[model samples]
Structures are given as structure tokens and as C-alpha cells.
Target: MKFTKETRNAGRGRRDLLSVAGAALATGLAGCSGALERDGDGNGNENEDGNDGDSDSGSDGDSTDAAELRETLAAADPYRMHQYGPSHVGNAGGAGPTSDVDAVWTFREGADDSHYEIGTPAVVDGTVYVPENHSVGDDGAETVVYALDGATGEIEWEWTYPRGTAFGSTVVAEGAVVLGLGGSVVALEADAGTERWRLERDFSDAVTVADGTVYAINTTYADPPTLVAIDLETGRERWTEPLADERMFWPTPPAVADGTVYQGGVELTALSTADGERLWSKDFGNAVTGPPTVTDDACYVPLGDGTVAALESDGTLRWRQSVERGGRGSGLHPVSSPAVADGTLYVTSAWRLTALDADDGAQRWTTETAGDRPPVVADGVVYASGLNVMEAYDGAEGDRLWRYETDASSSSGDKVAPVVGETAFFPSAGLHALRGADATSD
Candidate 1:
């Protein structure tokens, strides 16, 4: 469903705005609240440090293995639900809007003379790419994607896509921005903000980018729906393949792994990334809305009716677990995609954050977040967000660690992720950064 300010009960008038802004500002300040107090050993050696090394090194391993794992997890673009990635890292991660104690950065559009509520923002390199729009539709209004310095939130450049809403969250690859809108895919220069190429095809589905390729699903009224791939550097069509069957609306992107792209249309299909050739497809008899998580052995797909299924790379069903019983509990719809870390698969239903055995699909534990954002796991902890709550859980046993409350109904976009850092960076709900408390003993 479309989002409307009028539908929100955040309250109206000046008082509400100030309350929201002040709270947001306070949260942003926490971004740079301070270093995580560490033991004098210099190694993240505190019992609490888990794999302790240094305050930074312990948790922030720049090792080849860790980096490769990070690259693999982010490989399929976990931010397929929101516009931005895990968190603005490097310079952008250190930028002022994010470098304070509890700093909060909100995603807004160009409204009135100064204010606007907008869609997701895409972070590329050291800049944050935001959209300024008048409305959403083919002839609704035009959208301009602006590249802002992550540190100063300064606009470095902007690219406008005529006749498109700039509504979907964007992905980056090979120094180019790939966005889905106006029934098409558009690419822009990372530095100059110039349009490099565009493919017009109405897409309500989100997209993912990897290894210089783009994958997106499109739903139409008359024509059958399709999943298309385009060259990252140029918007030229690499291939356009029909979804498992016609009339299926894929709201999410496809996952890429082991040289094959995994997407759940009417069925989950493993397509050869090199040429968009279908290697195999698996049907679960349930409609899937987002990208499946592909590991070395399995693909995790979340279905719309309230279930998640595991399939092998060859289109064979391994196991299936129901996300919600039959009736609607709290999460009216399970919009967030599944996130895998270590050996568990984290999934969000309308009412809970659940951990499942990656190998067997058995329940491990469940939290009460009914998350709309993908959960992030680090140091044996799992983080998730919902309408008004952000929570951290023990990854091993699913124990509640801590819970923070935001304003009522303040949720980030569907694609947002809990960015791991010395402090967890909550970029959604505008932009709030929560710092980790001093580490005690394990």
C-alpha cells in the first residue's frame, strides 16, 4: 500500500513537529556519543568482547575473511527494503549528521519552501543519494536524485529522471546508481550525477545490484510480469525474462550467490548471472514478496500468506516454516526480508523477530518486534526494528538484550538494516544512532 502523511497519527501542528525534530536531533547526537569504553588490554579482550581484539579491531575486523563475509552478506543488497545500505561507512559514516551522540537523520522530500517527505536514500561511497519529488506516478511528478556529502549533508550533485517518481530504494555498483521507477531502470554517474542510461518499464518491485548487474521484477495489468537485468555501467538491457508465471507482483529483488541469481516469483528460480539463463526454478505454492537469502547450500524465501521456505540452489524444496499462525497477529504483512548470519536465519513477521535453524528451519527463539527492517547480527547479538521499537537480541539463544523506544509508529522503510558499528547506527526513523554501553564481563 502507498504511504500517506494523512494516514499517520503522529499528531498535527507546531508542537508535534518540534517534538519529532527535537527527538530526532537528540538521537543523531548519539552517533558520536563516545568510544565504546574498553578494558586496558587494548584487545577487545573483555569477556564481553566475544572475539576480542581491540575496541575497534575486536568488533571491527578488517580481516580478509570477515570482509569477504560482509561482502557476501551485503552481496545481494540487504538494503533492498530501504534506500540506504547497512550504514554510511568510511567518510560518510563519519559525517556530522551521523557523528554525534544519538544523532538522528530523517529522510525527507522537498516540501513547501523547505520541507518534504520522501522515499528511501541511497548511500554510495562517501555520499548519500536522496530523492526530491512532487508526487509519485508516470505523469505524477519528476524526481531528482541528489548526492550529498555524508559528513556535512551537503549536496554535491543531482540527477533528475523525468516522468519517474524516484520512489524505490536504489542500489550501487561500478560507480553508478541503479533505481527502479516509471516502469523502467535508470543509471546515473556517481560523481557527476549525469544520466548514463535508462530502461522504461513500470516496476513496483524493489531491485538488487551485484557484480555489475541489476535484477528487478515488474508487475503490469495486461502484460505478464517480468524480471529484467540491465548492465550497471549502461542502462542497456542485458536480458528480460518472464517471472515464473504471469500476474505475479514481486515486491522485492533477487538474491545472488554461487554464480546464480535466486528470485521467488510464482516459483524460486536460480538463474545464471552471466547470461540470465534459467538454471532451475522451484515452486513453493506460495507467493513470495522479497528476495531470497542464498547461502552455500540453501535459499530462504518469505511468502506473502505467512511462511518462509528453504530451497536448494537446484530448485528443490528443503524445508518450510510458517512465519505466523493463520490469523493476523501484529505484523499485518511480513515486509522485511530474511537476514542470515553465522548459522541462523533471522526473519520478521508482522508480530515477531524469529530465529530459525539455518540447516533445518526449526525455531530457535522469537522476539516481539514484528519487524519491518532486516535484523543485523554481530558479536552474537541480533538487532531488529518495528513500528516504534528497536531491539537487540542474543543471537545464540534469542534472549532479549535491550529495547529502545522511538516515537509512536516511527518505522524506517522496508529495506533498512541494523548497521553494526561500535555503536549501532539507526539511520531509519530519519536517522538515529544508538551507542553501546561500556562492556562488562561476558
Candidate 2:
């Protein structure tokens, strides 16, 4: 129940809007609340491999019909912990290899009224661009986004977005910091904290940038949800595609790969990355709350009701796997996004953590953590948090390597996400870092 504080608080008041921190793609409204920490750059690069870690390139396979694509994405990978993609491993070569000494640097909160909560952190050059929620008053009002030293957590510069309510994560690419608030998306100068351009729209969705354009969706309870692609430089709308049904309040961020942008609503939808044309759409079962993992010819969707599905790149369901069949109680629900590492997918449901084969959807291993926070895979290890504990697990196998406990209350079940670099970062009673046994190995 530790990670559920924010949602619980919001649930007690008004459950329509929740305020999420580091993971950025948080549901609900902002207030004095708890948040999940997040790593930036989805599947960017891992230091252990010598492969060229280009963010845009992926292995290609022969294209199939949209129906087959949906089936392929649904089949479930036997080797991965997530299907959407890997949680960020931090900026390329920023921190040395994970080691002992457990080094952790934190920025002091801006003011009593301003508590520091992070969105996804982006490490570029030597700087970690963090989107921070600085609470302005007791009403949950705040200014968001900050640029900091990745290694030291020192504040380099900061800025605010217009009409920005603290929600969703910052998307940093090509020297620009981008994020979405209650109804608009804005791009800022990553270095000087200057505003480049802003897209005004009624949406709280995070913007995915690729091919010099931004992809955003508006699906709050107030309006019909539509996915919109916009030019990053000029803030011009490229194309807009409406959803199948009018269901609102989606927390899943858009995943972009190859020439397509993959996302899910009440159902799964794939759109052409270039023209915003609809490529495919599939109904999994329940709505989707996280990003869909994409392969050259396949896509994976982790459904809200605890089903892991695989689909072809064109949107056909291949197979499905459920975590509850493993004798775990159905009370564990997956709201946080899953992380993929080394062909294995990691997912968190309420109080349970699971790893599955990316190719088969077979349960490789399952373990109970302190709370149900999403796991971050790095250096062959998974970093997860629960209740009041932070834990590390063998990424290849579900073996407990180490555990760290804190007096800080664990995050609410509805809001658990972790970020990993050379070290993994978690926010509990305070902030926590998990490093490897060695300190000097880069």
C-alpha cells in the first residue's frame, strides 16, 4: 500500500486526476502527493553490450497483415520482462558501471511549498535533465522541469511551462526538453531552459518525439481522445487520429519504433509515424495503461487486467499470458509500465513482480517485492520497490541479489515506477540508490 498514497489521496478526494512524478506518464491530478521515480530514454543503451545503441534503429522483419501483427504482439515474449521496451538505462556512459559505496546525490526541495518530484530523467553529455514538480501551494499547484548534473544531482538550471500541471514525464531528444500538462505540449531548450515552441491542446498525454515530429493524445474524461502528431520545430499539427471508443483518462505513453508509433487506448492502436495514418487497431480485453513494446514485426501490450499480449507490427494478436494463473491472487493489478531487458520482460502487479520470456509469454520467474513498483532492468539485474524496501534481482533469472529498506512509506500501488542507470533510483520515505559491489568499474 506504500506506493498507493497519491492515488489513494486522489481517490479520497476526486479520482479523475492523479499527480505522478518521475515516471511522468502518471494518471490523476497534482497535489501534495507521493510519486514514482523513473529512468529516461526507453531502451536507449546498455553499457554491457558493445552494440551501437542508436535509439531509432531496430531489427527488421517481413511485414504481415494487420491482423497477424496484432496476433504477434499478443503472443508474449518468453525472454522479456516488458513488451513496450526497456526502461531507460540512463544517458549513454554517464555513470560508471554499478558498484558499491552506494553514491546518491539529491537536490534540495525548492521551498516548503515546492517539493521536488521527478518525471523521467534524461542524461545527455554529462547532464541529467529532470522534469521536477515544485509545489506552489497547498492546492497542489506547481512549476515543473529542471536540468541537473546526472552524477551529482546539482541544479544547473530550471524553468516552468505555461498552464503546466505536474503530470507525465519529460521527453528529451536532440537538445530539447518536451512534456505535456493538463492540455498542452511544449518543447524547451535543454541547456538554457528557454522555450522553443508550444502546442496548445486539451490533453494530459506525454509527447513522443521522432522523425522531427511530436506525437500526443487527448483522452481525459472531458473530451474524445485523439492521437495527434505535430512538428517539433514549428509546433504544427501533422495529423490527428481519433480513438475507437470515447473512453478517457489513459496513462500509457506512445512507443515509437521503425516508421510507426505504437500506443493503446481502450484498445490497441498503431499509426504510421510519418503521416499519422492508422496502421492497425486491436482490442486486447481491458484498456491499456502502459506503452506497447515493439519489435521489427511484432508488438506487445501489457493489459490492465494482468494480461501480457503479443501482436504483429500490423496489430494482430498472436497469444496471451496471464500472471494470475501462477497461483498469485488477482488483487495484484498492473498499472505501472513493464521493462524489457536481455530478451526478458519484467512486470509489476499490485504486490507481485513477474518476469516472462519475450518470445513465448511463459512465466520465467515470479517474486514478491516490498511493494508493487515496476522493475528497472540494468547490468543483468532488476531494481524494484515495495512497501518500504528497495530490492535488486538477477535479470536473467529471478534471484534476489540485494534489498534496501527505508522508514519512508512505500509508494501507493497505483503509482510505482523505478529508474535505473549505473545505479537504480527509488523514492520512498526519502530517495534511495542501488549500486553494484564494485565502485571503480566503468
Instruction: Name the top TM-score candidate.
Output: 2
lDDT of 1: 0.50
| Model 2 residue 276 distance off true place after TM-score fit, in angstroms | 1.6
Q: Write the per-residue lDDT of candidate 1 for residues 271-323, one digit (tens) a residue.
A: 78787788887666655655677666777787765678877667777888876
Question: What RMSD value applies to candidate 2?
Answer: 12.5
Candidate 2 per-residue lDDT, tens place, 1-442, comes to: 0011121111111221432431222211111223223222122222232111111101113223222322422232211112213222111112222322232443432212223344444445445555544433344444456765444444678887532254554566666777775566878887798899877656554566766777777645445667888787888888887765555446466778887777766777777777778888787668775677665555777676768887776676777888642233233344445666666777766546788887788988887654455556655667665534556667666766655443332232223323434544444433333344343122
lDDT of each: 0.50, 0.51
Once fitted onto the true fold, the runs of candidate 2 whose alpha carbons sit more than 4 angstroms away are 1-101, 109-116, 137-140, 162-164, 221-223, 249-251, 325-332, 386-388, 405-421, 427-434, 437-442
Q: Which stretches of candidate 1 lie over 4 Å from their true place?
A: 1-101, 104-117, 132-142, 162-166, 324-335, 402-413, 418-429, 433-442
lDDT of residue 103 for candidate 1: 25
